[model samples]
Target chain A: MAKTIITLGREYCTGGRYIAKDVARALGIKLYDKELITMAAKNSGLSEEAVAASEKRHTHSLLYSLYTMGNDLPLGDQVFILQSRIIKQLADEGPCVIVGRCGDYVLRDRKDVLRIFVYAPKGWRLAYGKENNMLQAKDEKGIKDEIDKTDRNRASYYNYYTQNRWGDAHNYDLAINATLGHDACVKMILAAAEAKEKAMEG
Target chain B: MAKTIITLGREYCTGGRYIAKDVARALGIKLYDKELITMAAKNSGLSEEAVAASEKRHTHSLLYSLYTMGNDLPLGDQVFILQSRIIKQLADEGPCVIVGRCGDYVLRDRKDVLRIFVYAPKGWRLAYGKENNMLQAKDEKGIKDEIDKTDRNRASYYNYYTQNRWGDAHNYDLAINATLGHDACVKMILAAAEAKEKAMEG
Candidate 1:
């Protein structure tokens, strides 16, 4: 079978991380999140802490951009280069489910990449955030503000780097609303990913 | 067959208009593009020119945005309201394929709507633009520049209104790369639309 990589691009507090974990365990495959930066740092002579600190912000780190663009930043060119490199480095490490960080466009057109974007409604995301301790362990208003802030940061990072809006649905092979339940989201995505790989094989 | 509405969210040069025409002919349904503006304008009591002028610009003009945080200038909101109304009105009138102006989110959750997004790679889009007289008869570089600018405006409009990014891929039920050839795209999407409608009925 061809090496299959499943990348997850998700909305904040949508249980994207949780679902990714479930899918990885279900498939008996390694999962990636902050771990990607560690692998990239190790393979690319960068630091692990540096990778974590940067995370999605790594898409436009000046030193990396300079190396790619040959000189000073020229408007939008740097973003593409940074995103391209980050995506390449991730794909280079072999098959894994990457949660967010524009792995879809980075590996766009790769026959082996199965890109998934996970999101749910506002009510569901807020509930998930509270349940997962993503907020300050508070009620609706408190969590809503935090969720809004996180969603904005996520959107900005996605927009700045990929120049595409995050969670737009068309960018992914499968878009799931985890509000139905985490288990349900995992089931649907696993089905899509497995079938995609099988189809690729035949 | 029950009435089916096939909405077209297209790039400026992807032959979405033509494919839509083909779909309407094949399915014997109405097709709406810029023409819907007149219908919306009539229904909303705005002038046709005003509707067309605001066709895809969901942003308040620069001056309007400078004055407030958009609580006052309902220009952007107004465009969406108009688009949503028109989309619903069309759906109610019977099946139609709406092109552009954030129709997918507008019709989302509708038991009947099969939203689609059509896209092509840079080279293919440029070629389509030139072939379709959408490129202002420019050289490859010039056409590329125009395509970039046009898409930026489109993404800005879509992002602003839908709170979702244009061409993001995940938002649509079906997305296709039209670089495969216009007729092929038409055939595949027509089939997809039919299949999707069947699923919805089931």
Candidate 2:
């Protein structure tokens, strides 16, 4: 069987991490999520916390660009470049499910990769967050604001680094609403992966 | 079986219309495509040609909006509202497939409807258009431009009326790349529809 790499891009509270775990386990393949941060820390001299912090500091501001001018690539760019190399390395190593970190754009030239974006309605995501105790806010509005901020940061991070928009359908082979349930979403992705493998073979 | 309404939005040359036909036929339900224009024409006392012409006129320009200010709704808006009403009427009637004319937005409040957006890489779409004799342009560049113009018009049309951005993953339940092949794409949508039905039932 040929390698089929799946890059899963997701919104903040869509149970996307859980779905990625299930998919990797189902396919008997490795999963790369936060491990990319660790790998980047190892490869670069930066500590894991620094690497993670760099990612969180959104770089979309014109003021930020001006601040970083004539300096080494901004911290976020350095982290992104390092992680992109690691993502490509992982894809080269074997079939795996990589969640987040702009894997879609890193592997854009590859024929064997299936790029997927996972999202759900805001209400559904908010409920998931509340049920999972993932919310940092005490009230519904505050929680909703947290969720939107996270999504905005993600879009900002992605937009700053890539030519493509983060959640645009054109950038992905499949963009699925996570309201479909994790099991069903997994099945659909696996089916698409199989079809993709067959297409590559033919 | 409960009714399942499928609204398909497509980029040019993605074979989305054919897939819509297949899905409708397989489900033994009616498919609404160009039939929408005829219905709108009859209900609005306009000719089908007139309605279609209005739809193609592209109402996204600021000047256009300014020109129509404090006046009757522009011809495009009038056509769109009429069609939206017809879309709601048809969905109310029974399970069916509605393609294009922003059916997704028209029936946004319905839980039973699956909003799908279909697109393909530009190369694939161009190849499909050439093979099908769907292109009016004689040169490859000309044909590519034509394809882009069509997509731009669609995005503009969709953006002009709906609060949601066209082609944003948030607006649709599923967005599939047509490179997956029509059969695979159809099967995926059917699977999603079934999952949605079961979810709704529960």
Candidate 3:
């Protein structure tokens, strides 16, 4: 039987990375998260900071450069292309759980891929961020602003790169609310993966 | 333990009704689909045909009349209001599985409700329609048109009534691809509902 690759897209502070890690550990497969950026940097012979900075740049500026510039690709585009290549290469290597970086779009043609998106209600996400001390803002309003900004950036980045809208259920095999808890989320993904594999075999 | 109300929103030809029936059967709960229309019609003292017609009317015409009309409620709005009342009453009675007719929006305030959206790829849905002889049109193009129209109407109705966008992952507890097979979908929903119950208890 062929390996099933799982591509996960998530809203910030949804414990998505933790879920990804757990799923990978349970399946005994490679997990790619921030590691993709490092891989892309090595593949492109650029500094890791440069590749990471490209991702952090506002998408509006990236779009502006994409449309206005001549044949030369924008720094963001160059990094995205490199990362996409790396994602495909890793998927070709074996079954793995990849978080974010538009792995769903990059592996759209693969039959063994299960695309999942994780999100949570605003209040739940806010509370999780505060509880985990993951928020950079001190006050409630500032923390909300930070959360909203991060989500907006992620959406913009995803929208710019993929034909399908980010966070839309149609693009994924499963879109789960993270408030269900990490264990439930991981179990659901595993079950879905097994189901996908069985269906493919039949 | 309190009953968990499951509100399902699904695309055309996704076998959403069948899934609802099976889930309700497995849980030994009442399933509400077309029954809501009949209940609303009885409550409003209107003919069942009139209530059904109100739902089938194009949303654009409904919106136009809604904006133009003075104080009098449009037939569609009246039917919707009656259904909303019936839905609330049903919830008060016991746990049930309600399919479509914006049940998710109606039960949005409830703590024990699980909102699910089921969809399948276009090719899969089209094939399902043909195999089941569910499509009104004979030719492939006409069948495609029929499928598109039904989905469009459902989305328009949902978008018009709810604050959230239709088929958006954020609005649903789980948005699953029906291609995963009905059994897998059912099991995942049951698992999620169990997880939700445990979380609430905690």
Over 4 Å off, model 2: A61-71, B60-71
| TM-score (C-alpha) between model 1 and the true structure | 0.57
Q: What's the true lDDT of residue A118 in model 1?
A: 74
Q: Across residues A11-50, which tens digit of lDDT does each residue of candidate 1 receive? A: 7777788899998888877787745634654565554454
lDDT of 3: 0.84
Model 1 residue A190 lDDT? 61
Regions of model 1 farther than 4 Å from truth:
A1-6, A17-31, A35-90, A93-96, A101-116, A128-138, A152-202, B1-6, B15-31, B36-86, B94-96, B104-116, B128-202
Give the per-residue lDDT digits (tens) of candidate 2, residues B1-202.
Answer: 5378999999999999999999998888989995664575566686656576665736555346647674565666666767788889989999999999889988989989989999999999999999988889999789989999998888888887775788898889899999988888998888888888877887
Please give the lDDT score for candidate 1.
0.68
Q: Write the per-residue lDDT of candidate 1 for residues B1-202, one digit (tens) a residue.
A: 6366877888878888888889888888878885665566567776645555564544644344536645554444555566678778778888888887678877886867766677766776887777778768467777778888888888877777666667765566556555445565566556556555665565
Judging by DockQ, tell me the better candidate of 1 and 2.
2
**Residue-level lDDT tens digits of model 3 in B153-195:** 8887887666468899988999999999889998888888878
The stretch of ten residues in a row with the least summed lDDT in candidate 3 chain B is B57-66
Number of the candidate with higher lDDT, 1 or 2: 2
Error of 1 at B137 (Å): 3.4
**In terms of TM-score, which candidate is strongest?**
3
Query: Residues A16-95, candidate 2, lDDT per residue (tens digit)?
Result: 98888898898899899966646755666866566766667465653456466745566656667677888888899999
Query: Measured with DockQ on alpha carbons, how good is candidate 2?
Result: 0.80
Q: For every model shown, what is its TM-score relative to the native structure?
A: 0.57, 0.92, 0.93
